[model samples]
Target: MATLDLSAHLKEAKKHGPQARGISDMARSLVGSEILRIAGEVKAFAAQGNKVLDLTVGDFSSKEFPIPQPLEEGIIRALKAGHSNYPPASGVIECREAVRQMFERRLGLGYPVGSVLIAGGARPMIAGIYYALCSPGDKVVYSLPSWNNNHYCTLVGAEKIEVPTRPESQFFPRAEDLAPHLGQARLLCLNSPQNPTGTVIDRDALSQVCELVLAENKRRQQAGSPPLYLMYDQVYWMLTFGGVTHHTPVSLYPEMAAYTIFVDGISKAFASTGLRVGWAVGPTDVIERMSAILTHLGAWAPRPEQIATAELLNNGPAVDSYLAQMNRNLFTRLGKLSGAIEALKGKGWNVDCISPQGAIYLSLKIDLRGKKTAEGKLLRSDEDTRKYLLEEAGIALVPFLCFGLAEDTGWFRASVGAVSLADCDSFQARLTGALEKLS
Candidate 1:
């Protein structure tokens, strides 16, 4: 047998490097994740034996917060029972019913089992909504500083209408901000206990949004146009703190259920991001459409994991117990970080933070623009500010610009999901020293 060596051909191709050739327009136009890029730098720094408190990625460090005991055992038992086969393309019946019971029991939204569609995680469901509803060039309206909506829009060739939000409203689009665009939009996206910000929308604010969506869909129906759909991403719903409550559109107006698709999963709520179980609850017809689209992607959750998730969801006592403790642990760290930042602000450090509200994040503002570093380098943009913090303080963070803020506002997301109380304590000391090094 003889083998031909293609080393020369491979070298020539490698030497020329990639020119954007022959790829789909979407692939060519797609932007990479700045969060991951920053995280990569953090990893490299830590790899050099440098001590860095990595608060960049929106993920839990298993050591800091492991998945729940029951969930873990359930998976083990399932595998022992030989549940290794592919789950139904939609999901196992047991898991779907559990989700249905969960909605009615926890959220008070009564729906048939057909309304729930299971997937690998909330991402596929989100992508499914975009794929199932919007044609090319159809408009998708979402707030700025949101997670991955821009990339999804690009994936489906949908027109993007990003509405700018203010810090006062906690980075959530108000009814008035979204009203003008909804008439033309095919889908509207909302996430509460929002990623990168950790702010929960007030019930009144969410109610107003539901009303707006209702009115818009009503108008579309009258005109014989396709109904506008709402994709509510509530993956962090179970992790709220500080007396804040998580609200939903369907829960507010029962009629709104006809147009809402709720995205939820065990990732954030159970510290089980790697287990890959997620689902959506929506109108049965809409759920069917999403299923038809997502089925081709093989996006259904694993059979064993689905069965295990169903067990966990039905275990009300276990869920409540876990969440109560989880919330306490999360709030402890988030509060500590926020308090430390506030103390720095009180001392006039040009740093400020929103008090911890919900989710594993704290919205921090560290304005170092025009300030001379010890090396006389002027920090001019958010990236510059981020770099200064990461390099000098060894505290990694994801700047709001990465989340599509469009402005160099010096704001950043510091996630507590992967850090401990001690880690959070370390943040204050390092942040203070770094800020002091700046003029």
Candidate 2:
């Protein structure tokens, strides 16, 4: 066999047979969120730069009003007191009670302890709801230009229907707009004081949505169809600006409360996003299902953190102070951003600007076409101009294409929550400089 060298025949063999696919097709179908993708790249770019004002993350960055000092001391106390063990998956009884009471008083709704399921944050709470309530081949409806996480419905194997939400309708989808899908939708996920757009749904509009969803659900049931579920994301419920009170889904059509799962977290309200504490409250059956689902995921939130959160929430002063400070800080910065945007529009750029009633972001549509920069480059889409601004102007913004809007060319989301009033003035100047260069 002339030495029969095995190495000589190594390249002659073909590859192995294909393996079975364990992951769901839905998971594979999802693309990474556009905002996250761009934000990641911009962050990497900024890391190497000498100066970069990172406005990409929407987290608050004010030192004027710190998180309650006593609460921080309490967290340290809990840790030092050796309360750092694993907790009940449903959450500690004390914190759960505090959550229940907070909802009861804040939203004027009564919820027993069994109705709440604590998780890492609003994202998990939302995912748990989808897992517990929605099966594959279900349909989930929402409005367009909504939060990117709204696609979690699709990731959970539900068909996502995005109703058009425009400036004319105050950025809320009309009940009539939902008529076609109401009969078939298994879940409707929504957020108000909505992210990116910051449009609050009025009491009348919210009431109409509740009535329509419930009425359609009843019609489906009478026709032997399964009841639809409503999932409300209320993470920003407390961060309203300009005299807008947060509205809970439970406030409207309490009867449909049986079918709605409300997701709330301490991230936005308390600026404790790093704590990873959030809860979902709803009907007993839903909670029971979520509890079982959470068990498979194991140990609840950190015990000491939960205790600290409960103690802070139990006190009215800390929460009130936090809310007031947040409102004041955001109001001032939003005024600055709005003014800058208006001035840009006055400078002959066609821009679509939404006056934010609440939330931390200002959605902007900057005209990038027919613009030449100092570098002699012609402007194009939002991503193109976003990169130009970040690299040339040291500013970072999330382009709006991540929210599934096709006509969102040249659109971006700028967060004013972290920028101080002084910093905002500087930012406005930098923005105008960039605009002039492009023009």
Candidate 3:
């Protein structure tokens, strides 16, 4: 019997397993999330017992900001009622009807229940949108420094046409910025109260965009080509601050209803990111296609969570109260951080920030490039500046590069969803000290 060299055989097997084999070309071409990569670095720093203020993730800390009381309670009630079964492919009827009502009551947009498609979260819904509407080689236009649109395009093998937005536009794509590509694009993706920048599209600007989309669709119809579809991701619509009102394409231009698909969910608004519930509202045909794709993928939201979210959305008073408090807490932290950055700018420090108008993010500018640190290492890029801030100030944030901006862009996104008011204050002091060290 060959009881031979078991350790060596195990080593050989480990070296040549199926898991070590090459992946598909599509998988090979994909890039891992840069935000999560940086998050790993922040986690390493925190693991050393140091207090690191991590703002790299676009998520909530359940401990800092719990999901709404009604939502939590509703989930409990649902589970107790044995709602653990598989949900309907589109969604449980109760939840879909609630979403339909939510649109009518809140946004003044009347969407039929059949036009709604609920999924595990916004990501699956967005992916379904790509799979359903965009074919390989189709152009998908989205502004740079936005969220995961670039990755979504890659996954679906679409041609990415990135329109670089300027700070002057509050990092939002203007109609003029999008006009050149609309003639050729199959999909136009827009996010407002946009992620990473926390800026909203005003009524006039959004109206203009809707007009462009309508005009392009008209042209496509005449040419007998497929109409260009708009993916309006208003996930953070409910988190607007100050006087910034969220505008939807359908509200501005009724003609756009034929072309616009809205992606929304409780993940952002209700601090329920982990709850895995999101929805899309759009034309019946488009939504039906998305529902079919989601059905195959089994991306339905959990039955219990969907029931809970429906209850939460339908409870007008509970919904209003939760949003009011959530907005207040988010605004306080964002304002403090923005104010601190402004103060640094006042002292001629190379720091500035865009005023936070909505969402839980503040776009901060740390123009430390070409500046010498106390240790004589010259910060030459955004990555260098990010490392200096993390190591020197304990201020961890995601740079615009992670959001698909150019590597030299000095902007960074500081999310306050997981941080406390006290943490912001502490970060301000530490950041001030760190800036003072730059020669």
**What TM-score fits each model?**
0.97, 0.89, 0.96
Candidate 3 runs further than 4 Å off: 1-22
Give the per-residue lDDT of model 2 (tens digit) for 95-192: 89999999987888898899988877777787788888778777778887778655676667777788877677766788888878878788887787
How many Å off is the CA of 176 in candidate 3?
1.8
Ranking by lDDT: 1, 3, 2
Report the Cα lDDT for residue 229, model 3. 94
Stretches > 4 Å off in candidate 2: 1-27, 62-66
Model 1 root-mean-square deviation: 1.6
Candidate 1 local lDDT, 160-219, one digit each (tens): 999999889998999999999998999999999999899999999999999999888788
Per-residue error for 426 in candidate 1, Å, reads 1.0
lDDT values of the candidates? 0.91, 0.77, 0.91
- lDDT per residue for candidate 3 within 1-439, as digits (tens), equals 9767699878887786544655666776788999989999999999998899888879999988899999999999999999989998999999999999999999999988999988999999899999999989999999988899988988999999999998888988888989988888999999998999998888888888888888888888899989999999999999999878898999888788899999999999999999999999999999999999999999999999999999988999999999999999999899999999988899888788889899889999998999899999999999999999999989999999988887577899999998988898887799988988998
Number of colliding residue pairs in each model: 0, 0, 0
lDDT of 3: 0.91
